[model samples]
Target: MKLKFGFEEFILVFSISMFFFGYMRIKFTFMVIKVTDYYLYSYGNKGLLYCSLGLIALFTYFIIKYISKNVNTTR
Candidate 1:
């Protein structure tokens, strides 16, 4: 089989990377919460969590929309 690279491939790679990055960010955020549960009370960790979650949601939405808009495969 031959290799082919194009816009669809680029979007696929980008979306996958974004998903992994978002997952890591969420995991790391929870780790931080666990590690700093005491001090996090004054440091607005909740705000950080909410912001990160919003960003992740937006990224997911954009990726889904892009994939749906660009998808041309019939099989």
Candidate 2:
């Protein structure tokens, strides 16, 4: 069956991509920063980190819910 791609699908894909990108950015940031500079780096990008975490959480929740709903419906 051919599935129709719509706004919700687009959003889900976008969110998933953004989640990975944010994860990689945070990982790289931590990897590049020295232990001694951790506090300074965190302080400078506190808001950005928080926002990334928030998006990650939100995306995870929605993704899980979506997958669960699909699984239940398919069964």
The prediction achieving the highest lDDT against the true structure is 2
Looking at model 2, the pairs that clash are none
lDDT of 1 by residue, 15-56 (tens): 566556655555565667565565655445554555565566
lDDT of 1: 0.61
lDDT of each: 0.61, 0.67
The per-prediction CA RMSD against the true structure, in angstroms, equals 6.6, 5.6
Q: What's the lDDT for residue 27 in model 2? A: 67
lDDT of 2 by residue, 1-75 (tens): 889997666666766666666566666666666656767466447545654765766677688788989999999
Give the per-residue Cα lDDT of candidate 2 at 1.
Answer: 83
* Prediction-by-prediction clash tally: 0, 0
Q: lDDT, candidate 2, residue 16?
A: 63
At residue 64, what lDDT does model 1 achieve? 76
